[model samples]
Target: MTSASFHPTITLPASLCEQAAQHLEQAVQRAVDGAAAPWRAFRRAESSDYTLSVSVVEQAAASLLVLAAESAQSMRPSALRALISVALHLRDAADATRRPTFTTTLW
Candidate 1:
């Protein structure tokens, strides 16, 4: 768990990154719900047209890229979780499939 590790940040127009996470969670839940729609709560904060944080911007930018790249995508939580799981497993498989060269790790 070093600084280089992947810790995602998502900053939306209405609230902080955490708020965006919460909204995404709710949106996913909504996709599965046959029940009465829960009252969605979002605190509206003025979108700083000029507000700039490099990390937050980078995280949001990455998400935009993923979103833009995908077609007929599922924004649902379950789907996202499954996609992440599959990606992780596939990545592991690919790594395992590789011929280990001491070259990559060689001093």
Candidate 2:
């Protein structure tokens, strides 16, 4: 049996590379913060208001998707603009689908 592996390479201007790096860092930080937020809330989830607690948790998770869309938009790489747009649309759809409702279904 034979297996194949591929490595891809891309080159961009120094400034663009720097911008992309910054955007990536920001996106990672946002993701980390978004994840931490819900954990923090969960730790203090003894609140009397169940509705507010659920709302906060939902918002925190949704924030990760929003950050991804914003990060892609911020990078604005011409070559990947369309792909980014599609990703943003998908993220939005996911956020919409995850909207808080009376019925909570776990799959």
Candidate 3:
């Protein structure tokens, strides 16, 4: 005899899904804005302040990313993976901005 496997599915209301999607979008936008704030500051900073600005920016971006990821996790499981992928891309872009070859690099 063979055993059958069972998988469970959840059905959320349309309103609930919409609300969740909105929340996720807001969280992601906040993360993006917060991450970019450091870069703006870095641009205005003097050459001697580059190290400090980069350090602060990196920390802020990391914190915002973590918060956004947590928010995504709290929402629909189906969206969590996609949200994480977006976050990873954002982080990669943020890291690239810190490099010497970055187009906006003032140093």
* Clash totals for all candidate models: 0, 0, 0
lDDT of 3 by residue, 1-107 (tens): 33344222223234323333343345546664454444343333343332333344344446445655667647676666555554454345447665676387577
Better of 1 and 2 by lDDT: 2
Q: RMSD in angstroms, all models?
A: 12.9, 18.3, 20.5
**Which regions of candidate 2 deviate over 4 angstroms?**
1-3, 32-107
Q: Which whole-number lDDT from 0 to 100 does residue 29 have in model 2?
A: 68
- Pairs in steric clash, model 2: none
Per-residue accuracy of model 1 over 53-98 as CA lDDT, tens digit each: 3343333333323432352265666655544443343234334434
State each model's CA lDDT, in order: 0.36, 0.42, 0.45
Which ten contiguous residues of candidate 1 have the minimum total lDDT? 34-43
Q: By how many angstroms RMSD does model 2 differ from the true structure?
A: 18.3
Checking candidate 1 for backbone clashes, the offending pairs are: none
What's the best-to-worst order under lDDT? 3, 2, 1
> For model 1, what is the error of residue 30's alpha carbon versus the real structure, in angstroms, after optimal superposition?
22
Candidate 1 residue spans exceeding 4 A from truth: 1-74, 99-107
Worst 10 residues of 2 by lDDT: 4-13
Question: On TM-score, who's better, 1 or 2?
Answer: 2
* TM-score for all models, in order of appearance: 0.25, 0.30, 0.33
